[model samples]
Target chain A: MPLPAPSPNPNPAPPDAGMSRRSFLRTSAVLTTGLAALAASLKPLLEMNDFPTMERFLQKYYKEMTPEDMEKVLKRIEAEVEKQYGIRPHVRDLKPMDGVEFVYCLNLTRCIGCRKCVHACVAENNQSRNPEIQYIRVLRLPHGSLDIEKAEHNYAPESVPEKGYFYMPVQCQQCKNPPCVKVCPIHATWQETDGITVIDYDWCIGCRYCEAACPYWARRFNFTKPSIPKERLNPDMAYLGNRPRRQGVMEKCHFCIQRTRVGRYPACLEVCPTGARKFGNILDPNSEVSYILKNKRVFIQLKEELGTSPRFFYYFDV
Target chain B: MLRLVLCTQPRSSLVAFGGSARMRPVEGDALTRAGDPMNSQTRTTLVLTGLILAFLALTTLFISNLPGRPLRQPPIPLVNTNFLDTATVRRSYADLVRAGEDLSDFDCYACHEKGKPPPLRYDTNQNLIVPKEHSDIVMGHGSHGRNNNCFNCHNETNLELLQTRDGHEVKFADSPSLCGSCHGPTYRDWEAGAHGRISGFWDRSLGAAERKACVNCHNPHSPHFPSRPPAPGPHPLRPVATASVEPGPNH
Candidate 1:
């Protein structure tokens, strides 16, 4: 007997023809539920890895910020200093002095290698802790001997040059014609109108040409990044004088230009216990240096032959 | 169409019989061949097997011998390594101008040339440049048999015609500190006020810590100490003889 014609159903059952429809529906429901639960659990995992928030917390350079941006930076700097150093700092904005001339005069006969001037200078200038970066050097020489050879400057504690040696402190002479200014490759160093030579730390490329050009041995190059642990740092930093310096750049005694130009004496002059240093305007005929030059009979200048025309002058008791 | 060719092939009978399956197919024998289902199926299987084996062999050879093929290396990028070049020296000159420093006409190279100035000639005499006499005491040069030279104090950059910040040019090194290297004793004395000559009268108000450099006292080129003049004859004599006899009468 011929089988009854099969129903010509255009849409036949799915490939699981042997399984009941309920079984197929149950399998699909379990898969859908599992996928939904997995998606819900992954949402919090993705939120935990927020990268943008981390990038906003880092500090940046001063030139890269605007006035509005700097307020936030200043606040951050204040917070960091408090957290790291346990001290509050007073930050200020300072500018170079205009229309003033600063000159330094050294009395070689009187300097007594006490190194108080050196220490005072370091403190005033906010210098690095390394002893090698000292701005002032007190040399001891033999008495009654004009010969530089007989001079013994390497004195130990009780360093007063033996019975015959005299002391002299050498520093930046604030030359009217500074060779260092001429040699700087980047205009990062310049003599201010006030006669104090200054440097722009940010602008300096650390080529050390200025150090090579200075005649007074007044300039020093920072070989490594300065370390002034935030607590020891003097926050009343001068723009051209004593803000913590960078590595590989040249620096010199600015005659305490920041303080002096503000109508105050340099730290060395203020703290000198022996009154060996004299600071005044050479241009003013009535200034103390001018009076000293006029009244002193035993006055002399170092390397007068080199013609550097240094403002520093010396005198001794006859 | 492919089935018809396989069925017509003489290899179809060889495939069905196993050992004789290597025979080549001949054209124009479709109907009788198709009647034998087993032979057609065997022929089709053999052809498919041969194609797959050829493809795999090619893939294996290509992967194994890849290391023997030549490689192309990328080119190096350019950089500004000319830090000490003439252009840099010239830029230094520009920097001086911006800083407002004056440039003297004295170019360091003019006097410091290798063959022209004569090696080891610091002064006009052409004698080996000697350290200042005091450098011995200050720098311990006496211990070294005076081995140090002007180059020791005045470091040489070995570059010619270095540029200044003002577009003018000068030497690469400065004078005072260069001189200080060998003249350490003198330099220290100058700093401490012991070595160099002092100018001006002493005052109680001005401190002794402010001393001048050695260059301020004796010249580096002709460092001669001025001889002290003899004391005047009318100076006070200590322990003078008293008129003892006349004093006794007055008492």
Candidate 2:
């Protein structure tokens, strides 16, 4: 009886079995809107100036790159710098030398706070002229107080060594236990074997956690596109040093990595008129930094309580 | 729901507060009964339309009354300043003597006759008169003006050489040794690369580390550092001028 005849079907199939006109129109409308929304969401990426080429975008981490890879990367960087600055830069990847540990010593009695080091660093590092990024900040502190919170970094006295104050030029401490390195989620910055902390600008995602973590306020973030005058741009650049940094990267005092790794004095140290700044290999017993550390009596690190064990030492000539 | 019912019904018809009362259907109420559904609906529609129109009108007025957004100005480029004068800061007497450049500035024989020392002249106050030939030299070597005698640093026997307190003659480039006779500790520190600036390789095997002589930074006549205008302060990204102090005299 059940197979006798098929009762009149409740609903008949349409001519187009796969999809009806109304459903097709609805699906197309949803998909089109979705695709348009997706495109709109991704619009801001087009404004990024940092990732100019695929080679730069896909560059390996600093430690992961071999010498061959570094050569290619260095050449690419040189080309990019030349294209932007109108001068061919000698960008070399200088590795740390064996048995050399860098250390910096500042003589508090001698520093006059002329800020020559500050401008010299800007000039040597190819820092942005308009925005004016300086690695060194000369703080004017009262003689009676060691309070850094009360220190004035923007004092523009007619002359330095102001009557009741002492000058302390603060930069990256290059701590043995660096908080900035610890806070870098992407491992963009790390201390080298030679005791200088360096940043791989390409690997940095610009989260700025390291900036927040630095107790010395050393790390500087590039908020705008960095612009250096072509004539003033420093052509001698290193992979981890003063290569022209892009818009959204972090940079700091790398102990003049380009110069220091190749057995040259840092630009800041060379420019200091008072001879307050001293840098040398601490491992060498005869080095000046070692002499200062051993002989100078009133030695102090800026923030020694934090256990950063800063490589920078400040001493008085009592 | 309770608020809607209360709004729709007359005030007297409610038995309890909104919390205790159960919601009722909004369809056949006293307000609906008092007038035809079409008339009531038309009134509600007119009220809603008027409210929306008022809101939109107020929003437009408010927006128009608001102050205009301030346009951000681009940062002015820093002007060229002669703050990093390396020639003045890093002058090495050794480099000058080695290069055999013009020594007229420091040459005693250029002004004074060779093999004859200029007579030391003293003013009424016993301050060295610093003869007209060397009038540019400001004598402020000692804090108390006790060591201002020309003979204290100048060699009387030979005009070309400088003499230490112990009578040892020194070349112009080797004047640091002469300075050591008086400033013993400072001289020691300088020899150890602690007192004066060194501007070359830290590692000696790789390159030469040029140590600036004592006279390089300090004028031998006036040992005190002269006051001068510092480099310009930082201009941060926020656009606020952090340094309120204006540029002053470079003395």
Candidate 3:
């Protein structure tokens, strides 16, 4: 009887195996709810206004781009900057000049900690105003001490060169063996031929490895979309220099690459009331930097024990 | 897989409920135990559905609380931070010369009689009393009033010319060399392009470098740099009001 009942069905459905209408409804409800939850979780990404366009997403790495590619990129950047800030910027990709290596010499004896350089840099470079980004941090330290840990970073007194204190303005050292460049997961930042450690803002993933790796605390991250006043926008821009940065890219002092490459003094150097900041071509023997290195009492590089070999030299006139 | 897990969860929990149901005289067991109006599987499904709904609600609440775009505020005003003291006597002289300004404005003899230099007057304290005509000048040139006399730099024989310590006549434009007469080291540093501000090109082939004169930064009457309020410091994302400098043992 069992043999007769077993028909030649290779795939047999048991009595209770078929899907009921209730079960089907249950499964569909679960599926719909799960899909709704997934959609809800992605709301933030959908609301983002700064999501990259197809062109920006597909743009080549900075070093890999040809001159024609750079030209197009610069033009695109100009258009983007204009659209965002309501001013058409004169953006150019200035190359490091031949027979030039920039070196900065800061006379510690003369720095009054007026912080004019910091503001000048902010005006020159289009740093964010709200949640402000300043390149130079003037540390007010007690006299007869060289320890940076004991330095006051946020000291806002009535006047600078306060009694029993000295000022040291610290920015990017432009290290020859840069730890920031080495630690970047993507090679978004690297040292140029002219000793400027430049970052390709477009290629950066905002991981902030370079920022963390920097010994000088020079690197800054744009956590939000930079809010710059349209009227205050600096039109003279360089691709890897003072060009307005996007949210989540790293930026630091490039020795005012745009000005330095075009044979103009940096805004910071020009704005120093005490004439403390000195910058020149280290390659030229007759340059001011070379003279200071030879004649002035130049001390060890900032955090030289880390072997960063910073191009910035601190000197004493005594 | 979710259904399988959901169905399995209530069996153990239902067993615990069953014990309590049985303890109830008869109505509790009839309502919730094995043979009831609503079966255990249906009851478990309802419980899980309610749970999923609650979880989704909480998740939605959490997502809404996440940080969004910052509220647009009025733009922060830009400040004039170029604090270089470029409005001194030399700056005015340089500006006049560059503009090809009338020489009579600067010519001392235009006010004073020909071949007559103004007599130097001193207060009872022996401090040089600046005349009413040159009341704008505040003389504090050298330490301890050593170089306060007008005849030190200004020539008495000729009102227009200035004489260096070596008796060399120096024009106002070449006053850096005149300052070199006393401040030899500073002048040397300035000549070598180390001292003072040097604008324009560092590479000589590209452009001419403009070295600022001594009086461009320093006031001839008072050479000491006057202290002023510093520019505002960094505005960090997080407001940290704590003092950064802790008096450590090393300091």
lDDT of 3 by residue, B1-251 (tens): 34432232233333332334243335334445665545755765675567557766766665675555465555555565445232332464675689888777468876888776677888888898888888888889988886778878877778677788768887877777788999998888988888887777777787897778887778877888777788877655456775755333322
Candidate 3 stretches with Cα past 4 Å from truth are A1-37, B11-54, B66-75, B81-92, B101-105, B242-251
CAPRI class of candidate 3? acceptable
* Candidate that would win on lDDT: 3
Residue A208 error for model 2, in Å?
A: 0.7
- lDDT (10s digit) by residue, model 1, range A35-110: 5556545544554532322323453343455666656644554454455456665433344444446666666655
Encode model 2's per-residue lDDT on A1-318: one tens digit a residue. 357775653224443445534334333544554565565556557767566688887889999999999999999999988888789999999889999999999998888888988988888888877767888999887776677766778787677767777889999999999999999998999989999999999999899999999999999998778888887888999989999998889999999988999999898988888888999989999999888887776468988999999999998887
Taking all chains together, each candidate's TM-score versus the true structure is 0.42, 0.80, 0.83
lDDT of 2 at B93: 63
Query: Per-prediction DockQ, in order?
Result: 0.01, 0.25, 0.32
Best by DockQ: 3
Which parts of model 2 are misplaced by more than 4 Å?
Answer: A1-43, A49-52, B1-71, B79-81, B90-95, B105-117, B237-251
Chain B alone, TM-score of each model? 0.27, 0.67, 0.73
DockQ of 2: 0.25
Report how far off residue A289 is in candidate 2 (Å).
Answer: 0.5
lDDT tens digits by residue: candidate 3, A11-107: 2345454465444545565676677778777876876889788888999999999999998999899999988988999998989988889999999
